[model samples]
Target chain A: MTAPAGQRGRGRPRDPRTDQAILAAALELFTEHGHAGTSIEQIARRAGVGKLTVYRRWGSKDELIAAAVESARGEIPSPGIGDLDGMSYAQISQVIAEALPGSARTLAEPGYRAMLAQVFGSSVTHPGLMAAFWNDHILPRRRTAHLALSRAVDEGVLPPETDIEALIDMTVGAVVYRLLRPEPPDADELLAYLRSVYEQAGMIPRR
Target chain B: MTAPAGQRGRGRPRDPRTDQAILAAALELFTEHGHAGTSIEQIARRAGVGKLTVYRRWGSKDELIAAAVESARGEIPSPGIGDLDGMSYAQISQVIAEALPGSARTLAEPGYRAMLAQVFGSSVTHPGLMAAFWNDHILPRRRTAHLALSRAVDEGVLPPETDIEALIDMTVGAVVYRLLRPEPPDADELLAYLRSVYEQAGMIPRR
Candidate 1:
């Protein structure tokens, strides 16, 4: 409750301290008990903030979830168009190897799984979460992959008639399948395998 | 409570019907509110049985959850070698076509998603579930696909050195990726794409 002089206001101010604490608490509980098992009261208690404070800040459980997700998880940014334009297969696999672990760990969490289940668990009722992930992350990546495939064509690497969407689907889709495998291949192995498969498909220059 | 005629020998033991009722009620509640959201009192009232009955049958919420999943949402049976053998690509696709929809729909349910989130949400902790699915269902299918591919190779349909596992991963994986997609592709289109991809890999006999 120290009133930092620079940010002091006339009314009772919102606390950044409480917000960080809440996000941390939510991550812990979501990791431990799963998103479905966690409750607002539990998060508030873990954060050392009042229940009213949490509710006042985030409103509903879903909103709180969204806020926590915004803080705790971020997607891989779309590769810059220039980066995509000149990217070699080695460069592409490198980006994948770099980002795959955190993506693996986060997706490996029960909290994230529960969120996926909610988005996908009931296609009739809870499709929004899964849909947003595609629009936000999955689809954009495919688009980038497609443009890269076109560049590969221009570079005389792959056959011009190769289905870019299918090619991209096979590459990214394999990454996902590996992630969900019982003994998921390590990030390095996954990247190597991806490189191998894409190379076989003639997306990479033959050494 | 209907007293069993044979139970009179033991001073009329507690009604098995009551026990059944309580189990059913608990299952219903768990499916509605998830593992953590449900309460003993609510289960008892729904079952028209005593709270003590639930406590006696299963000591803790986790135990009750185990019972419900075991009894009601039990394991799915694998498609046998017979189905996978000597089938056209369409028939192969049809097997997945019929089976995946139900699994996909069930995955979409909130409470079910919650359960999965609890189990598979943190996939690192319980690799067992994912393993079970592969061992029980996917591995057998892979073997069948191998048989088909072997036949294709024998018939000079496919390249001799082709890695069958990677191909299987790509073919089957595409369907799985689509199922998990935010905007799940139409089933008919999905099957067509799956067949086309398999044909491209020379898994099926080409004219």
Candidate 2:
């Protein structure tokens, strides 16, 4: 239970900022050093907070790391599945175009690449991390992509029998494959590649 | 620099069997516990050999892991670019069809998935490992895929303006994506999905 302002101990006051700082530090540490490499003490040290402060919020390291990764959802783009519900093909394309610059920038970052690698690597051994990632980060984007594909089918751009899941896998997988390469693409290259994949899939019209 | 068998000490003779054992152990350790978690001592212990045996063969952990990863080149399927050269589109498709079963089986294995995750995760942090994997494993396969795509262009299966690299990325990426999912597809499903992506890409004729 969170103590009222008056009932708090003599420790530094806890606020939304403290939670943000702890989560950010956790994400950075987890990205740099994998799940096993990072520890709660390290997170607190990096966050300039007491170990108890982190412990107070999260019951375990997995929980903390899960929260840290979930925090990254805002940094990456999602399809805005609900908003896209009734959008036309052109409208969907516009949303994707506007989002590409930011998505490309984030995906191109070395830190983000490492973070994704860590997450994927942990899937078998550390199921909790992968579960959190899948639920929060992956599912929404996947849903959005599915909706867009459905729209494409309805609009007669893709044949009704088009394997939408396969298309999503290819589009997402291609981006990941590019990122994991020894020489990953830069933002501009990544943007061009994303546009090309979407255009090829008929999700967006070619220029 | 080899001591003749007659000149060898009481220790076990350095032989191909020993090398295989060490490499197998190194790969197993690296897959189970990532690059950072594995150690030479553990590898030796796992292989039932002396620590010096591993050191005598590989100068460092990175070299050992590199060799270990390189040793796996035979396990995964790659396009035989030379064989595919000048072959008809139907011939190319036959080669792919024959290869897909083995590829699907390997890709569906949990151990293979974990190994891939480790290799990809280490790309930025451990370039040496990725370099060896690329040179020994990835490069040949990529070359084969490229040749196949070029053949598709020649056969008029794909448009002349087709982005072969993008198509290749999607196919490989889709397989990898499927493997890393929480509920990864079984061999049969993986085979079907692979066929779908290839068929969609015009790399192989749809049945």
User: TM-score winner among the candidates?
Assistant: 2
For candidate 1, lDDT tens digit of each residue in A1-207? 232233333356867888889977875665455456678899999999877777767655555654564554464344545665557655654554455455555555545544443333323233444454456557766765666567767666655555666666666666556665666665456556665555544444333
DockQ for all models, in order? 0.24, 0.56
Kindly report which residue stretches of model 1 are placed more than 4 angstroms away from their true locations once superposed.
A1-18, A70-72, A75-78, A86-126, A135-137, A153-161, A184-207, B1-79, B82-127, B149-161, B185-207
At residue A92, give the lDDT of candidate 2. Answer: 83
lDDT of each residue in B26-79, candidate 1, tens digit only: 767765555456787898898887666666666655555556555445443335
> Per-residue CA lDDT of candidate 2, range B96-143, in tens?
878988988887887888888788778778977878877897678777
Per-residue lDDT of model 2, residues A1-207, tens digit only = 343233434455669898999999999999988898999899999999988788777767899999998998788876677888789877887787778888999989888888888887787778788889889987888887887788889898777767888888888888887888777789999999888887776667778
Clashing pairs in 2: none
Local error of candidate 2 at B193, Å? 2.4
Please give, as one word, the docking class of candidate 1. Answer: acceptable
Candidate 1 Cα deviation (angstroms), residue B151: 4.6
List clashing residue pairs in candidate 1.
Answer: A109-B121, A110-B121, A110-B122, A121-B107, A121-B108, A121-B109, A122-B108, A122-B109
